[model samples]
Target: MQQAINKVELRNLQIEDYKELKNSMVEAYSELKEAYWQEEQIERLLEIFPEGQLVILVDGRVVGSALSLIVDNRKASATHTYEKITGNYTFSTHDPFGDVLYGIDVFIHPDYRGLRLGRRLYDARKEICEKLNLQSIIFAGRIPRYAEHAKEMTPKQYIEKVRAKEIHDPVLSFQLSNDFHVIKVMKNYLEGDVSSQEYAVLLEWNNIYYEKHQQLINTRKSVIRLGLIQWQMRPLNNLEALFEQAEFFIDAVSGYASDFAMFPELFIAPLMADYNHLSEADAIRELARYTDSIRKKFQEFAISYNINIITGSMPLLENGNLYNVGFLCKRDGTSEMYSKIHITPNEVFYWGMKGGSQIKTFDTDCGKIGIMICYDVEFPELSRLLADEGMDILFVPFLTDTQNGYTRVRNCAQARAIENECYVAIAGCVGNLPKVNNMDIQFAQAAVFTPSDFAFPTNGIKAEATPNTEMTLIVDVDVDLLKELHEHGSVRTMKDRRKDLYQIKKLKS
Candidate 1:
């Protein structure tokens, strides 16, 4: 297998490999520098990585292994935490969407030392990312001496005590050797003891510094029906076949006067439940190929239908890391793209990519709009950011199952619209998807959620498709009303703020 070189094959380790990997990790780290680490604690690490990507080498007779966990560079997400740390608020409803990566836990075997195996394993993980095409790889480093890797070290700490994790862990050294840059020092998120403080070092590897757009746009409201489609039960094994299924479903309502449409997270790829049996690296690479093909199809669909179609979440190969990104195209062939900002824990654990840069709202002939995929809308900071930046209609595209989730999200959409006084539209999938592990716990049915301003049921159900069915919701957005509401109420949330007065401090070196 190409995965194995120098008598070493980088195969994804399974539950069976957990014991060996953990032992190897403890031996290697302990030998380098003694530390107190439990077998169960290491076991939790195994659980965190589950079965994603691994490298196993056969040196002479013994087999050695290494594993990598894909963590998000979600540095500076908790503005609420900042208020507590800095003794003042950092969030003024002005800005949000943190661009940080916590690429942690790259474990290797002790017996596998010498022969530059450590660098080889690091390069291999990076190579896997390159083969698949992703955005960036961020990892967390220990503090103190690692302060060189942190956002900042407080004056008090600078004069006295040293931070432990930043100084003790070898991740900082490992990442620096790999050309990863330290972006910030995370403050007060992870909890341990007060004596040995823990601070997350945001490290990133990217050619382009992904940026956020905070500019507002002018929009008008009109009636429009939109559909969020999720065709479940498929852990998509074949890209061609999956795309065909999606094409068939969308083609059914192509000629209708629908203004827009969407799909849910992993909309174009497979959803494997069990990590132990899969190599997410390969899966992500495969999904990238599918995204390229599907995006072109989506553009063609927009041109043919003479509408603005919003393509749902797909793995976007930016550089070497695959990002959960969405695409928007108009009939004229022009396009806009939005990368997901707030990622779920599972997503970060599975893929080594960060969310988007900013809360960008695009101004189009159709309307002044913005989009937040699935979990993105769950963060209040993001909602406040969009409103602060002046967006009219926010589109939430999702793939949800379980009535509880549907209700929570559906109600949340309305709440945001009421608070922001803008328009809200959602597209969802309704079906039973086979889990990579459970194969049960199917998703809820699909529907379109609209805001209250549109007469009765203020939560407008323009034209919601039935859950567990193949369909599209079509309606016109009243961009004018959205503009009117924003001018009067929704836009007032940020009328007062003092940016320079508050110090946005992170637990520093």
Candidate 2:
């Protein structure tokens, strides 16, 4: 009466293991008439992608197996039937350079079902997916229990019930618990899947680390560090004083290895102290004179400090009309300007500011980004347009006179992050400039926001500066999480848009 030796191992499937693998597959799917893979089919899978074919052994016996193949999703779409995906068991749809790893089969022997061997096989596939840098792991999961409820409800209804835990579907429940989300309910997916009534679900598990191009896999950054300046507004004696203060924050943020440093909108308004005697309109016009010098000095700081700088909003006097403009000074010596698209009534009355018509996202070493001034971020359409351009981050530089104004900017910015599925970093000026008429009595709380999901903070606020305080808030955010949310989040706002009913279009004016 000696106890049986217990041992477990997981590895790539060898050709000699085919017999045991087929036996395990048959025993696991005993309800199906044709449940085992042919010897030649297993050989072909090994020939095409040996690394993708995995098997788990318990005490020198094949107890579980998982089969997968790389596929060009464009050609073998998730909606394609099992026969088409597998080329009628010939596995001709397999493409070594494809972006998705398609799971064709996974089973654990009925004897080993309670041991969580199926989970091990699924986990192993995910590890292989990440190692190969595939965009995601996709599979047509069978809803075997659907047949029981098919007479009473549709496949979709059945799926919803299973998702809500109102129904217990062995396979679907297992997949849902493992972080695999059902993209859609696929019909007639497999011919002999009688228990599933020829129905299946297109399930996907996105690999957050996936890079579209293999060459840039190591070069592209996942985590981007942001440095936001809760700038204190005070009277400045001269242009040198403003530049010195700007350089001080830049030097400090760069020292902390921040990728981008953002200053609050109209941070240079304090320099208008010398023009306090002039009217509000005339004084801001005079402040616009330093736009060129500030641009040059910030660009210099960008290159010297090796950190990208967002110059906030400065008055630009162009063609006798004033506009609030900002500069994106890349550390590589390249610079781009974005003008405020939405002008506040106060800006029009006091400064006679005219809104700019153009809006676009800028490309930076860290990622593609869009800049919006105080009033601009409050408009949902503008940020949505930027998000359409694949913008990873939306930087909003604001100057608010009171808590009510800051609340508008803060709430809208947070909404943009959640709806657009992107990061929003907002910095604003605090303190007061009593000498400058329109710039007096500022209130702000600089903060960074992220898409609301399990991957991000519960409240969606990454970091925030103390209210109406002069401080720098530094936070690190992963751009990869946004990609995952776009494809496989709890609620995919981008993908679930009802485009047929209505659409958001940029009109050519």
The candidate that wins on lDDT is: 2
Expressed as tens digits, the lDDT of each residue in 1-509 for candidate 2 is 11453888999999999889988888988989977889999999999999999999998899889999999877545478988999899999899889999999999888777778889999899999999999889999999998899899999999999999999999999999888988888888988889999999999988878777767343868899999999999778899999988899999989999999999899999988889899999999999999999999999999999999999989999999999999999999999999998899999999899999887889998889999999998989989888988999999999999989999999999999999999999999988788888788999999999999999999999999899889999999999888878866999998788999987878843
TM-score of every model?
0.48, 0.80
> In model 1, how large is the Cα lDDT of residue 309?
71
Tens-place lDDT per residue, model 1, 134-189, is 34555444443433433465623432233233344344555665656656656553
The positional error of residue 360 in candidate 2, measured at the CA in angstroms, is 1.8
Global Cα RMSD, each model:
25.9, 5.0
Off by over 4 Å in 1: 1-221, 230-237, 271-277, 435-441, 448-463, 487-509
How does model 1 fare in lDDT?
0.56
> Which regions of candidate 2 fall more than 4 Å away from where they truly are?
1-20, 29-50, 56-63, 70-104, 110-123, 135-209, 216-218
lDDT of each: 0.56, 0.91
Worst 10 residues of 2 by lDDT: 1-10
